[model samples]
Target: MALNKKPVKGMKDILPEEMQIRDYAISVIKETYGKFGFTSIETPCAESIANLTSKQGGDNEKLLFKVLKRGEKLDVAGAASEEDVVDFGLRYDLTVPLVRYYSAHSAQLPSPFKALQIGNVWRADNPQRGRYRQFMQCDIDILGEASNLAEIELILATTTTLGKLGFKGFEIRINDRRLLKAMAAYSGFPEEAYDSVFITLDKMDKIGPEGVKTELLENGFGESCVERYLELYQGLEKAEDGVAYLADMLKGVAETSVTDNLREIIDSVQATKTAGFEMVFDATLVRGMSYYTGTIFEIAIPEFGGSCGGGGRYDAMVGKFTGKEVPACGFSIGFERIIMLLLENGFQIPDRPKKIACLVEKGVEGQALCDVIAKAQAMRETGSQVLVVRMNKNKKFQKEQLMAEGYAEFEEFYKEGLRN
Candidate 1:
């Protein structure tokens, strides 16, 4: 039997070219997020099954890759259910681990701790372009800050990072979970039915308003409720200021402070943002996470034709772990999708160090080899990217490959050069 060399399904082997771009993007994320006072943190990729299944991860929980018990603990024959065998699972996102981290380490961390987390997450789902079962996630979160300042800083920092990566004219579609509940309540929906109603509303972009109406009605909601529910959406489209209009419409139904905080976030980001993007008030934006207790937002890039990343305030998640609720908000950038877009758009790393290659003939050895090594080290010390390799028999092909890897200059060292 032959051993398989290929990676598992939905996983990929990253080549040097893509890795280069990924590394550059990571550097940018760390640098930009650090400027905003976010300290880098790390959590393990594997989390306890209990934490992964805590229902805070939204749809991702369904995609968890559960790890079975090992060796003597396996008990396969006696296992009657998955829970009987599985003890841990690969994390589907970073937020759950982050919360656990905070719950465990809050004593040592500062108040209003700002965190920058970047790591690989796994989801056992079908793979597609710009998505994989295993991929990197980049997140910046603020914990212990109850003010709208958290949301504002997250928006500014995330957009600034995107802008630095050459993303322009993107839309940060913002919404509040409270607003969704208020609108539903004002439309006569039962408080308990908000989740079901939101499930349909989330399909608005894909199914349109009429489709949402049809689904809501088919789901046993009253027609009057559906009619009044969609009317808010129609009015928002025609209003010059969607956020203001919604604020006025839901004045009594939703807390004035909820919409007020939302408006402030939009206004603040617009006033002080360095990125070229629109901060849109999307009434129908239903982030699927059930744990979102307040504002929710997503990043939509015209180039991707879909959401590139999103997050919201999950104020209750930590409480589930420690019995103490802390105000928290996070923004995650789809690292793989961002890389895909950059690769497709031929994005280059700005101000990259000079890349040069030294191809030495195979026969060149002894003091000559030492000279080549010394020269390469010197070039590297001066902040240049240097590649030294033996000359290939197919030298032209090797040079072409090197050129593709961004080697702009090449030096050929021959045996005669040693004599010289």
Candidate 2:
């Protein structure tokens, strides 16, 4: 059988055009985050199955791509369960591996370590427009910081990076896990049922309030709880400031500080942000990750009509690896999605070096080639991007292709003098 040339399902071969944007975006991300004191770090793409399934990743754990035992350890025929045969899995996201990395390196790293990690993650999810089973995730996380400063800095850094990438007028929809629980609690939901209620509430954008109500009622929740739970959303629509309204409503049910801290984060970002984005309180926002203990946020771009990326505070996740809790929070950009949007919009890299192509006539060697090579090198040293290649017979078509690759100026060399 002929070898298949296509990539496996849910994966893709990035073409040169898209790779250019991806490379530029990564440079911008690293430069912007680095300015905010985040140091670059790396972790293995594969992690132990035990840590991946520690219940911190929520729905992503279900989508893990497990790796079977290797060589002598392989006992698929005699294994009674998956655990008996599988030992590791591809990381579903960066946060889990980051926490594990921090647990092992905390002794040598600085307190409140800020890390910038960019890598591929795998999930056996249904591939869609911008989502792939295998895709890149760009994450910035801060560990060992117990104050709202972490949240504030994270929001500012992420938004500034997006703005540098030419994203504007986007929405940073903010919410708190505590507020979600507090709303459910005040609405008379059982403590154990908060997750179930949240699972339905998360669908509000898709199914609408009536759909959420029907689902909640069908799931055996009290109609009164559903009514009261949704009533808060109704009030939020009319309130000038939803965060203040929620703060007042959840006064005694939730801690005063949770709402206060969240409000302060929104105000701080709005006041100091150098980006063209809005920070709005979204009580209905429930980041799927159960590990998020406090402020949760998602970036909404009007073009995507869905979340571009998101993250939140997960103070207790490190405790699962070590015995003691450490404060941690992260924000991940939907890397693949951002690349897709930029490609769709025909985005161009700003201030790029002038690209020039030098095509040498076939069989033109000796000092003529040496002169051409010397000229290209000199141009490169002067900050020009030069591509030197043997001239193709189809010179016009070759120039057209080179032009598409951002090579606007071209020089042709033959036995005679060079022609531009």
Candidate 3:
């Protein structure tokens, strides 16, 4: 049998149409994020399995596309464990690699480095709509900024970028991991079990409040703790100011500064935002990363009916690499999902340069071809996209295909003369 020509499962081949949108989106993301002082950076796609499995990546650690040792290092029969055989894995997300990058380069980098990273990540995940085993990730992060200003700037820059891409009225569902723990504490949950409780809580959107409560009880949590914890959600549903309610209710059980910092982030972003989006206080937002030590958030687009992107404060991540805690926060836009939404909505890249097709007849001589090529080059220098191709037998069908590719004006070079 012949070898398979298709891409492996859960991966895709991007066509020219989709590639155009992807390129345009990257440009918009870079330009918008650059205005907020985030300099571009890069990291390798593969990372050491040790760092990838450090338990900071939540479920992503399980989905890593592990890379095995090569050459003489590949002693599979002699290896006692998976780690002994596999030494590296493709990064599932940008954050881990970014933290490692910062740790390695901090001596030469600025204090509170704002980094913008865009690249492909791989996960051995089952593919679905707007999700794939391999996809692009665009992230902006601030390291060494210990205050809520980092959060505010990240939120503003992300929303502004979305707005520039023509998204509006979407929701930025914001929450604090600290607040999630505090709520659990107030409900009498043991401090050590907060992670388990929040894991169940993160399913509220899928299973609803009743589902979360049932899961908590079935998982051996106390009924009183479960009831008290869920009752807060019910109260929040009725309250106009959910954050204030949490602040007042969890005051003695949680730190005053946690609520204060979150409040400031919300107020500052709302006050100065240039985008058409909502800053929502979602008590149910439990971002799945185990490393997020403080605020966490996700993007919810009504049109997509799912999260478009998200990130949070992973202050402890850098410490894992550098041996000293550094304050850090980040926001990642779901690059692939955003492109899917834009394509679904027929988004047209604004201010595109004029596109022209130069079709030369097969019978045209060398001098004529050279003249056509020279003219196309001149047009390109003057800020136009010009495509020169040999005219097909069926000129009409050729022009039709070119039209679908966004070629508007067409010039036909005949053996004797030119036709427009």
Candidate 4:
């Protein structure tokens, strides 16, 4: 009989070779996040339907992997759920559940709490290049205080960490959703135009100016207003030169509410960051989340096919449930995507050996082999992979067999590992 074993279409098992790179990326993220006063926390993989669906923007809820209630008991809770659910659905992303966790436990947390979360997130969306149904997301968020300073710090922290991890040619694109709203007002678009405008803006980089224009027109955007927005990306502006661009866009806008909020954003970016990431006042960046009441960003490396990761402010998410608004902003990096970039581009990360194959002659010396096994067991206790090599015995024949198997590292006969 043939063996039947393979991962499902959108999932993959991490092989030993790939695991070295994966662990290194995770360690780099954890250590980097720790220095910024962000404490690590984890929530359940399954979250209640209410928490998952409640106020999550975009098509995120559509991707949720719902867990069926046991033994037809779902009928008992039908139409009107007495309790939210015990057999909850798999979490779509860490943000929603993290917000739920914070809102429920806010009294126990310090004012202006910062958290670092790293975990697997599932999306039922069709897998494509660099996108998997199950993937890892690493995020750091600050909650309970509205501070533009937090945005600056988060950008610096992420760039610094990625730099330390040996990435190059990457830039952090920063934009204030407040400023997008200001532009929408300046252009005389309405409140209902909010979601569509941002989503269209996000596709600007991907679809080119003309394509975006066509899309907007197809989506019912007036031609004259779209022309005014397309001017932001045409010029060659570096990170340092973006302030002038922002001032030009916001100039003479009577909406002081948006302008004043934007001044805070400008000051936050201008106050001198030691990290080498460019911040552009991109009026074009509308992070797809509806509740994003402030700054938004996406990090991209030029060599990669897509933005490495992105996230932004979502202040109204928690307020819908708890009735008290919580100020919050965060970003998530595509963990597996980063690994692919490193592996493909020769980015080196710390590596550890995952397997050790030990070999022994069949009938030569059981007692002598016992000593070798003892040493191997000691290494195994410390989490080293060790496999005792068993073979048909005749000392001379077995010796040749071991060498042919590339087990010459065993010439030390038990002193060193297989690779040695």
For all predicted structures, in order, the TM-scores are 0.97, 0.98, 0.98, 0.81
lDDT rank order: 2, 1, 3, 4
Q: Write candidate 3's Cα lDDT for 1-420 as tens digits.
A: 999999998899999999999999999999999999999999999999999999999999989999999999999999999978999999999999999999999999999899999999999998999999999999999999998989999999999999999999999989998898889989999988888998899899999988999999998999999999988999999999998898898878879898888889989999999999999999999988899999999999998899999999998988888789999999999999999999999989899999999998888878878999999999999999999999998999999999999999998889885555
lDDT tens digits, residue span 340-368, model 4? 88888765444544445566645535667
| Model 3 lDDT on a 0 to 1 scale | 0.93
Instruction: Between candidates 2 and 4, name the one with more favorable TM-score.
Output: 2
Counted clashes in each candidate structure: 0, 0, 0, 3
- Predict model 1's lDDT versus the native: 0.94
* Model 4 regions lying over 4 Å from their true place: 1-4, 76-87, 227-241, 251-276, 351-358, 363-367, 373-420
Q: Residue by residue across 1-420, what tens digits does model 1's lDDT show?
A: 999999999999999888999999999999999999999999999999999887787788999999999999999999999999999999999999999999999999999999999999999889998889999999999999999999999999999999999999999999999889899999999999989999999999999999999999999999999999999999999999988898899888888899889989999999999989999989888988788999999999998888999999999999998999999999999899999999999989899999999999998899989999999999999999999999998989999999998999988898963522
lDDT of each: 0.94, 0.94, 0.93, 0.73
Clashing pairs in 4: 358-387, 358-389, 359-389
Clashing pairs in 3: none
lDDT (tens digit, per residue) of candidate 2 on 1-420: 999999999999999989988999999999999999999999999999999998988999999999989999998889999899999999999999999999999999999899999999999999989989999999999999999999999999999999999999899999999989999999999999889999999999999999999999999998899999999999999999888898898888999999889889988999999999999888889999989999999999999999999999999999988999999989999999999999999999999999999988987899878999999999999999999999998999999999989999998888676445
- Candidate 3 stretches with Cα past 4 Å from truth are 417-420
